[model samples]
Target: ENNEVVYELLADMGWTGDSIDLDSWLPVYCKARYGGCPAAMDSAWQQFRETVYSSLYSYPRFTWQTVVPDTRRISKLDVSDSFLQGVELFLSCADSLESSPLYVNDAIEYASYYLAAKADDCYKRALKEDSLGNRVAAMQQLDRSVEILLDVDKLLASHPLYRLEEWVDMARDWGKTDLEKDAYEANAKRLITTWGGFQEDYAARFWSGLIKDYYIPRMKLYFSEQRADLDRWEENWIKAPWHNTSTSFEDPLQSAIKLVERYKGE
Candidate 1:
């Protein structure tokens, strides 16, 4: 039963069936290491952690405590500045669109929402201590996430899914006699204006709500150490003159951090 439960948990976490049965004793392991379990299932997880630690750290010089660094020094995520900037950019554009505005405006508004959501997600990830790093890196990743969201948003807004003729036809249908004359005019005008403004608005957004509840508090391990910035970082990393034979000096963590930084830079 213990083995089965362990296997099931692992499978749920995306582990293949080939791994060991470490689930049943997890809570015990947790208690021994982390003091206690918040829930019944955690008991098994605690035990499993101990088992793995014992197996992996049995060497004379190995120390489990040292391997997983004492997390006491880990500070709370300080993504306020970067997150604020991202949210500001995201919401400023998002809040301006009226509902049923021109199709182009709608597209731009939708893209803005998408970008904001992504930025929020990145900020939350940066706050996760288990997955977080130095302040600079965290800020950088947050910025990068926003920039990508904005760029892609604008790109999507500019290249609308439908052509101008299709949009005009749609506006006409919505502007029929049943609709108020003012309503028709307003809707038609909005649609037309949006056709041009979509490119300008790109990823516009409404105001951002407060920054609380943006990230998971306890489950920090799910956050990423890699920079969220892909385009610029990849360009630099791949094209660097010194990247030829120095795998030892290749810092994936730093590269990821740099990407996030560059994202904020723009």
Candidate 2:
């Protein structure tokens, strides 16, 4: 259960049968991890369960995270009201949850997801603007999308679990020599970026350094009509020196509060 963590896989073996009653599981999991669960958080988790624990989503990413900035992707889900309500309820308890690493990390994670949804909206709007021949308007929307992604990267930096620097640093630590360190670091970057043919973004993650370093530039190149040497450009980045500077907000809870109020229900 711990290793093969996906319940969907267990369903086929009749181990899960179907949904594993999150109502019963969440409170216990919360206690084990955070010592206690607030009523608001439980209600928020129930609201979120409609989107997360309710289904077996095949893709872990949104349309904006695709290899190219195409808006035709099937996983383009509209942000649901339940998800927004959950976010509101979750943020309402920020004062209570701020001290717990697990809670703070969850706040960062949830905020990042909401921001990604907002970014996808901008992405879709950009494409629509382009279709209407509004080049300047389209670029504005595209630029806004990029801004949101950078914000996401910043938000995720405060999170221990989702930060790209954490992954890359662990890769570097696995090496006994400088050459091996460079190789391992390159592998780590590649796994998140060009994870090989036909699977370039199958497991796309919106991590801190990854968003600014990889996705930001990819979106620009896609918009600039520079399709010729994109693959080589990615290779260059993979083999390049590890010089990405990690960044984060000092008070992630307050940062989250500002972010939520700024783009609430957008």
Candidate 3:
């Protein structure tokens, strides 16, 4: 989401002699992206820039990406609410903009961000339940959270740029032999999960393969109350053979539509 917007701004600055593009850049970028920048879309992006992208945030990775209960993971609802408003406004313009490939891509990403925030809400609740010694309730909420993450992966997979397959496949393709292939793939997975020493998930991404095969499974073990050596588990996964299969997917906008409808009321 930020990448496209930043690129748009940078590209515009490159062309303009003065190198100044502010709110005006958004509609022009939107028009170039979706073929037309309607008023609602303009407003949505305005809110997005003001609220979400206006400054740097301490946490780039999601709370669940920590893979453990953490006070730092507790996000303020106000920010999420503001971001959701932008998402809603963006989707409201879908009737006119949905046909654009860029719009479809952004729809999947924007709506996925909404669903991810909702899932993070459940993760926080699960942490609270666990703190209260309500194991059953905690487990239930954790299950729901991971379920949403898996679904988020599905929604993300609709776009080529967001798939974990692209990450791993690109790395593996760099190898000239099976050993090199495995080494490259392991390094690729390791970068996202365990980059050596105490930085598990420091570079975590909300990608399809990572969530389904990596994050969700790790979360399950974390909440299962079992004595799990997470470091060992993570290492095993990194060195293990690649198991994520790339699949055909629906149009991104269609996936976004179904996903947002399923979780919006939650």
Candidate 4:
């Protein structure tokens, strides 16, 4: 119902199921949200710029459209009506351990994309309002965008299957006993790291402070700034430190292993 409400809001805001190019919109969004904070804006701008560049080498071209949720498919599966049916199907396939990995992996991908789509929709609305000079409306939409993203994070965290440790355990118990804990952790880390290479291009956001410390404050600055101060804002934002754009880095497998060990201790 909550998701439905959000979708309705997006529809009312003129979302037409079309793809939005994050490469173009992200800079604008970041400027609106973080323009006042030089440090924040620079960090965000660098990440966004790198993400766009990295997508050139990534297969299928990572873009907002690529991750947008298939509302048609989601609509077909009425969760309330099909809950029992889904449980029954799961029970029926309980013995099929071979397919467990496939199912779990697919679920992760689906959830990530769905959340990305929701966030993107909110972003588009925010952009529209900003363009129309509706500062308050734009701020509201931006806040909604971050709220939806944080909610998705919470939802994923609440689901056992979405947790890395749980996923590893499930795979290990399902006839992959040979899968070492370190290897499993490394694989999970790689999945997240790769997806996050393009500035959370695949909904790999893990930080909870993003909204409170960065996004909201930036939007506030944007709303507070006068038209005459826009040039100074841009100048300050551009002067912030620029991080390296290259994302061709190896996964921190050892760190992932340590994380797994700590999770086990907990």
- The prediction achieving the highest lDDT against the true structure is 3
> Residue by residue across 53-82, what tens digits does model 4's lDDT show?
233222331122222233322212212212
Q: Show how many residue pairs clash in every candidate, following the order shown.
A: 30, 0, 0, 1
Q: Estimate each model's TM-score.
A: 0.21, 0.85, 0.89, 0.30
Cα lDDT computed for each candidate against the true fold: 0.34, 0.75, 0.77, 0.38
Q: Highest TM-score among the candidates is held by which one?
A: 3
Order of quality (TM-score)? 3, 2, 4, 1
lDDT of 3: 0.77
Candidate 2 off by > 4 Å:
1-21, 67-78
Those runs of model 3 whose alpha carbons end farther than 4 Å from true positions after fitting are 14-21, 69-79, 245-251
In model 1, where do residues sit more than 4 Å from their true spots? Answer: 1-101, 129-133, 149-266
Model 2 quality (TM-score): 0.85
- Residue 44, candidate 4: alpha-carbon lDDT: 35
Better of 3 and 4 by lDDT: 3
